[model samples]
Target: MKSIIFIETTKSGSSREAIKTADRLGFYTVLFTERPNFMAKREEFPDVHFMKLCDLSDMNVLQKEVKALILKGIEVSAIVSYVDPHSYTACTLADHFNLNHFSTEGMKNIQNKIQSRELLKNSSVTPEYWTVVTKAECKELEPKIKNKFPLVMKSPKSTGSKDVYKVGNLIEYRKRYNTLSTLYENQPILIEEYLPEPQYLVEVVVHKGKVHIMAIIKQDIQYNRRFIVMGYKLLLNPGVRFSNGLMKAIKEIVAKHGLETGPCHLELRRKGNQWKLIEINARISGAGMNNMIKAAYGINLVEEMLKMALGNDPDLTPKFQKNVYMQYVTVEKKGTLEKVTGKRKALASQGVVEVYVKPRKGSVITPPLSMGHRYAYVTAVGNTAIEAEANAKKAAAEIQFWIKESPKEKITTVIQ
Candidate 1:
């Protein structure tokens, strides 16, 4: 029997999708994770066997475990992971076991923003960028590169826009770097020219030197001093011209960057007539966006990626298409969630497929300043963009947030 292995699996919806897909395919799914109790918490997954690991970052430990398994006469057919920092580890293990996967070198190209830029240098998608180690280094190189203000600084190894900042001036830039310096210590930070709006993302899966283009996601991002991805909306009513242009741009960017094997998420910005690549990573889109993909196009990327990892050709063709949107739930205030009303109303509305609110009645909640702080997301579909968008918004707004505000500093009146 064929066996599939997933490393560093978190107790997330995406992780569930991957393991369940493997189980459905009749593959014996073995999951390695730091949280072994996650298995006991889950009632499903009768076929999934959970294994505990001491450290996910230590490749030596992981290598030893897999090697031991191999010596036991167990044949590991495929290896896969959905997380970012762990992607390279997955590739490394796959290479060691001679399993099918995107190469470790290619993983390096996209894992770091600076390295990804280096790989795409001299291409039409190339954007201005710089790397700095300390505050002094950033100050020294700030005025030297392109003389562009309002640049964006980001962590080279970051995921979900954590430690990412936008600086309007030199002072702000220096300050942001100084704050991040203490956290990152010696790691280099990537600073790049801020691309304007009309940002987009494309999901592509590559296998055996072949690139299969999936959906083209139109992003609605909120940028203050940082970027908070508000939504990934469907592309409805895109004329023939726009469709051809988007497809061409996506194809060119992936081919130029040499993205081969596994599923990759590509982001780009379209300014007037020109399209500039933002960044690309070898992973599935997160934040429940994968669910939206399934609802919109009847394509389960998690399932497809597993098949790809096993050297099987999964269907890339869209089974059907609909207007679908992933709308994030952001709190307006910080407090314990007293109550949430409007699920029946939201679900009762047209085009609303799913409404997932994060905060429980007694759980503490805060405004979504970054991806980590996002409260919940709702997925909706319709025949048109307006319908789907309206449905999602209506559903999200219907769920009222009644937070019992945290108590302020109390003063004693004994003096009177």
Candidate 2:
């Protein structure tokens, strides 16, 4: 049987779904991961043919592992990863094996914010940005951007909304810069002009330089300490004129950056009458995106991406189309999760299709500092966007998290 290798996977979401898809397609599936806890639960992944523990950060270690598999007569068909820097690692390994996948340069362009922004600096889609490596550089650039308050500061490699900060003034800018510099240590920080509300996520599939706009999701974001995506609504029909303009922009961006094949998701914001590029990722979006897309369009994106990795043309035709909405469950305070109640009720609610809750009992939970803080989600469908959204929210409200506040300890001093 032909084999496919997965470099690392998210605890939940598209990555895990891809592995299951590959197994169902009858390919020998092998997983290399650093999480022993995940590997220990072998019974959970019965479809996986092999699971090996390895230092995923070391390419030499991965090379040796693949060589051992080859010695055992495993015919490797494709190497895939949904997370980065493992995504970049997978592309490099595909090149080493002469397999079909995205170019490492293209992946890097998508992975590195600074590189992508610099490459598309002259384009209309490019947002105004400045790169800083130190507090001195931030100070030097501050005067130039004095009037541009409410800018965003972030590490080039940050993901999942971590290490991204929105500052309203010079004091906030310097404070955020110090925090990021301390976290990254000599890595360049990108400060970009903050785009206002009405952002959209474009899920794209490109094959042999042809771009396919599979789904356009309108995002509902809540601004707290970080940008928290509270919900998503898939636009079943985004109109021909709007779709055409978005397609034209996406095509130009993909061609200019050389992302000739594979799956990519772009985050764009509406500025006046035009859409501006926020960032691009070289993988299908995580966090129930696959589920949302499948519910809305009846297209399995993860399966399609797996097929593409194995040098097969994907079937992108929509089997059906409907309005779908997803709402995330989050807490407003920090405490220990004692229990989660109402899953059955939420699942049984009208129009609710899926209800998933993460975080085991006694796990610490906090408000949205990043996407990880979201512990549960409810997906629902309707004949209209408002109906879908209302149904999702109604179901989400049925589920509740019971958390216990941590007790404060009193300190005692002894005098001798």
Candidate 3:
């Protein structure tokens, strides 16, 4: 039996997908994470093991620990991780074990958003309307600059939609900038032109210099300027199509930066007839975007990564599903206790595949819905794209958010 190691195997959809892939590959997969306690929470799966690694940034210590694990009779063949910070650790471990892996340079280029953007610019694949801002110097920036308004401000190092802001004017830009700068303190932010078309994300699984599209997902956010993503659905939209030119640009950028192998999630924006490159991710994205893409496309990217790590080529074919949509339930306001209506009835709706609800009736909710803050999520599939999207929306609408209005927004007392 082959043994594979996954770094940062926390309790996430990615972790669940890894387990599924391990089962499919029939390998003894060991997962290393910061939270060893996560092992106690999950139900048992045969041939799956969980280990813990502390402080992914501590390279030397991690090396010594891996050596110790090897000495302790753990037969490890390949190293893989679904998280950004852990990609470097995976590369290091793979090199130490002499397993087929992406080079250290590749990992760095993809993981560092700044480096990735620079590479894109050098290859002429990036758009012309993007600017990087350091926290200190950002105060001097004119948010209403004639050049780059109606823009997106994003954290270079963030994963998912943690601190992204869409600013229309100078006031909004400065307000959001100060809020983020005060919270994060000196981290770099990217301000780029906000493209008007639907946002499309492509998941690429690169093995031995060959790249395959694992999935294509279209994202939906709560509002235009909100950083938090409301949900994402599989891309079956007619408008969503990749061209040969864009593919060549991506390959050139990846090759130039040495992003030779691994799972990458690249975001692209379409303006009129031209496709512009957004930032690329070194690792898999949050939500089950990759899995949905695999289920739709029949290209098992996780399984391919596993095979690549084991020095094998993946079998690829065009496996495409008809239509699918995934959505998240977000609260409208903050309150102590609330009631969710029509949950059981919604679950029985046609084409509803799965539903995950985190908050009970009385759970506290936060604004700008994030990865773990979502009260619930729904994934649906159907014969038509519109049907699938409607099913997800219907299911989400059933879950009511009965929140009490905050004192600041209250107008009743003032009028009285």
What do the candidate models score in CA lDDT, each in turn?
0.73, 0.86, 0.67
lDDT of 2 at 128: 87
lDDT, candidate 3, equals 0.67
- TM-score ranking, high to low: 2, 1, 3
TM-score of each: 0.89, 0.95, 0.83
- Score candidate 1 by lDDT: 0.73
lDDT of 2: 0.86
Residue range 256-351, candidate 2, lDDT tens digits: 677888788999986875778988998999879998899988999999988888888999999998899999888867888877788899899888
Between which residue pairs do clashes occur in model 2?
none
- Better structure of 2 and 3 per TM-score: 2
lDDT of 3 by residue, 68-106 (tens): 667878777777787767877788777876874676688
Could you give candidate 1's per-residue lDDT for residues 1-416 as a string of tens digits? Answer: 46787885654456667887788888777777776566566564565764554577787888887777777766799878887677777888888778855766777667777777876777666677788996678778966753688788878777777788888787888788888887889989888888776888787777776766677778778865458787778775567877777667766766655666667888888767667777788788765766788887788989888777877788778888899977776665677877777777877877888776665689887665577666666789977887787778767766666777734422110110
Q: How many backbone clashes does candidate 3 have?
A: 1
Clashing pairs in 3: 297-319
Please report how far candidate 3 places residue 72 from its true position, in Å: 1.7
* Candidate 1: segments with Cα more than 4 A from true spot: 35-47, 68-74, 145-147, 406-416
* Error of model 1, residue 198, in angstroms: 1.4
The true-versus-predicted C-alpha distance at residue 367 of model 2, in Å, is 1.1
